[model samples]
Structures are given as structure tokens and as C-alpha cells.
Target: MASCIFCKIVKGEIPSFKLFESDKTLAFLDVQPLSRGHALVIPKHHGEKLTDIPDEYLTELLPVAKKLAIATGAVEYNILQNNGKGAHQEIGHVHVHMIPKPRPEQGLGIRWPTQPTEMDKLKELHEELAAKMQE
Candidate 1:
């Protein structure tokens, strides 16, 4: 993770507008923000994806996100976590985007695209997932 920008930020090699820090994680303002109080929350340990983070670290990570949300006075907001290239993950480190909604200029104006799926296929897929969860 020597070249990872987030790791550099965590290590103080790169400057960030840091907001909050716990033993396990750090929260900071994004240089390029979606909204006024837009922030990124990241684990101190480098993890490229969600599952790579230890559960103990994750437990501390989320409450910090909530703290940022409240500290920013985000009356409505979204918490975005992305993984893998296909999921639009620009940075290889696992981080959460806390974007306050109703920004002065409509915020980031992000949208979730949807596609239709057959109900029978959905039911079968759900059943398959439920079976997998037990394993």
C-alpha cells in the first residue's frame, strides 16, 4: 500500500482535511467533495474491499460514520461503500463516502440505475442466496 493515496493520508505522508480519528479508523473531508460536508471514512489498516476489513475494525468504523453525519449536521445523507473496479472503486482502499443530502446545488445529483428482472428468477435467486447464507 505504499502507493495508495489513502494509506499515504493515514500515514501522514499526504495531507487530508482530517475530521475524526479512532484507533481503527479515520474520517476526513474529501478534497473533491459531492457536498459541503462530504467526507470519507477509512480504516487505518489498508483493506482494498469491505470483506478484507476485520470485524473488530468494522464495528468502530460505522459509528464514526454516524458521528460524522451528525457532526456535519446532515439532516439526510447517504453512506456509500464501493468495492472492485466494476463497482467504480477508484481507490484500492476500502473507504465509506458520507454525503449530506440536499446540498446547496442539489448535492452530487447521484442516481441509482435500475433494470428489470423476472420475478421467478428473483425468487429462485433469493432462495439460492438464503441457502448460501447458511453455509
Candidate 2:
């Protein structure tokens, strides 16, 4: 984590427009923002992805993001977290983006492609996942 930008920010080696900080989490304004109040919330513990971080480190992430959303006065927003390069995660640390959508043309724009569902296949997949969850 010596080269991780978020870790640098957490350690105060890199300067950031920090908004909130606690024992386990840090929230800051995104240097390159998509909207007026775009911010990033990160856990103090270094982790490249959600599964890599301990559950206790992750507990404050969403609560802080929620606080950022309220502080931004954004009624409509998107809370986003990406895991890897293929998922567009530029940083090698887990971070959540709180993007405020004040208008139709702003914030995170996504195209969710919908596919027609095959009920039997869907049911079988659901059961498979449910069985795994029990383990």
C-alpha cells in the first residue's frame, strides 16, 4: 500500500479536500469530479476490493456516503463502488463514489442492458446461489 494514492491520502502524504475523517473511514472531494458535489468514501484499512477488506472496516463506508449525500443536498444520487480494472476501478483501493445528480444530464450515467429471462433457468440459478449462501 506504499504506492496506493488513497493510502497516501489517509497517511496525509497526499493532500486531499478532505470532508470527513474517523478512526476507520475518510471522505473527500474527488479531484476530478463528474458533478458539483462528487466525493469518494474509503476505508482506512488498505484493500483493493470489497472482499479483501475486513467487515469491520467496511461498516462505516455507506454511513459516511449517506452523510456526504445529505451534506451535498442531493435528493437524487448514485452510490457506486468498483472492484477491478475491468469494472473501471482506477485505484487499487476500495472506494465508494457519492455522485449527486442535480439534473438529467449530470452524475453517473449508466446503460443497464436488459435481457429476457428464462424462468426455469432463472429459478435453477437462484436455487444454486441460495444453496451456496447456506454454506
Candidate 3:
């Protein structure tokens, strides 16, 4: 937490183009943006993954994200939550990227390649996930 940029922003040690702030969360413009009003919504407390935060805390984040998305006049958007480095997470803290997809000219979407997978493999994964969810 001492080294986290988001924590620094929350503490006012680092300057951020702030959009919204609540007791439990903070939303701010991304310094390096993918779109005109790209923002990052993060928990005020240090949480490294979705599972690390309580359900109540996580649920509250959506409305704040929505408000920022609408305030920025985003025609379309993606709420991307990255968990860890293996999933392209650059920072250790949990933050949702509010990428405003205003136009194709901006090239801000769906670029990650997907490949077809076997149905049996999908079924196996689904079964495993379903079992885990029940725990």
C-alpha cells in the first residue's frame, strides 16, 4: 500500500484528475488514457483482487463506475477488471478500467484475439467452476 500509486492518489501524495470520491472508493482520470475520458475506479482500501474485497464493497463500485461513464458521455464502454500480472495487470492494486468506446477511429476495443475451443474442454471447465462456486 505504501508503494501503490492508487493509495498515493487516495492519500493526496500524488495528484490525480479526480472524477468521483466516496468513503470507500475513488474514481479518477487515467494519466495514460486509451480514450478522451478514460478513468480508473479503485477501492479506497488496498485490495489486490476482486475476491480480496468484501461483496458489499465490490457491489458499491458499479454505480460509481456508471456515473463516471455517463458523466464522460461515453457512447459505449468496457469495464475491465484485471486481477494479477498473468492477466495483464500492471499494478498490484485492484482497479477497473473504464474505457470509453466512442468510435472505431479511437481503436479502443476487442483487439485481444480469441480462438475456438473444444466443447468438451469448455464443459469440463464449466463443471469445475460450477463446483468451485458452490463452495
Candidate 4:
């Protein structure tokens, strides 16, 4: 973790364009930004991936991300968290990329294969997931 750039940022050993910080997380402007307001949200504690974060800390991450997006004047935003090498996770630290989507021509453009799901299939999938939820 000593070599991890995000950890260094959290520790203040390295400088970042810090936007927000709480007991559990820190938000800063991304050095290699996808857009003008692109920011990275990271847990104060070092974690290798999303699942590595404790549940308590994880709960605070998104609301902070939302607040940051609004503070940065992001008309819309994408919260991205890559988990492993196959998922294009370049950094070892668990950080969320909050990319401001101002216009179609701006920010990271993502391409994905689109498939249509039948209404019945969508309903079934929703029901199945809902049933599995503890709450």
C-alpha cells in the first residue's frame, strides 16, 4: 500500500486537488481526468478493491460522491468503480471515478453492446432480486 498513489493522496504525502474529506473518505480532482470536473472518491483507509472496504465505510461513499458531483457543477455524472485487472482497474486502491458528463462530446464515452430484454424477463429478474434482498 506504500506504493499506492491513492493511499499517498489520502495520507497527504502526495498532493491532490482535494475537494472534500470526511472521517472515512476523501474526494479529489482526478489528475488524468476524463472531463473538467472529473474526480476520484476514495476511502481514507486503504483497500485493494470495492469489496475490500468495510460495509460502514462503503455506505458513506456514494452520498459523498453525489455531493461532490453537484459541488463540481456536473450536469450529470457517472460513478465508476473497477474491481480487477480484467475490469480495467489500473490502480490498486479502491477509488470511485465520478466523471462529470456535461455534453455528449465531453467526458468519457462508453460503448456497450445493447440487448433488449422481454417485459416478462425483466419482471422476473426484478422479482428474483427483490426476493433475495435481506431487507
What is the lDDT of every predicted structure here?
0.88, 0.97, 0.85, 0.87
Give model 3's TM-score versus the native structure.
0.87
Candidate 1: tens digits of C-alpha lDDT, residues 13-126 = 999999998788899998888888889999988989999988877876778889989998889888888999998899999999888886557455666799999999999999
- Model 4, runs deviating above 4 Å: 115-135
Question: Arrange candidates by lDDT, highest first: which order?
Answer: 2, 1, 4, 3
- Error at 10, model 3, angstroms: 0.9
Q: After superposition, how far is residue 87 of candidate 1 from its true place, in Å?
A: 1.4
Candidates ranked, most accurate by TM-score first = 2, 1, 3, 4
Off by over 4 Å in 1: none
Better of 2 and 4 by TM-score: 2
Instruction: Write one digit per residue (lDDT tens) for candidate 4, span 37-131.
Output: 88888888888888888887787778888988888888787999899889889999888888998889878788898999899999999999998
* 35-98 per-residue lDDT for model 3 (tens digits): 8888989988788888888776676578888887889888798888888899888988889888
Native-to-model Cα distance after best TM-score fit, residue 67 in candidate 1, in Å: 1.0
Clash totals for all models, in order?
0, 0, 0, 0
Error of 3 at 92 (Å): 1.2
lDDT of 1 at 113: 92
Q: After the best TM-score superposition of candidate 2, give how far the Cα of residue 75 lies from its true spot, in angstroms.
A: 1.1
Q: Candidate 3 — worst ten consecutive residues by lDDT sum?
A: 103-112
Q: What C-alpha lDDT does candidate 4 achieve relative to the native structure?
A: 0.87
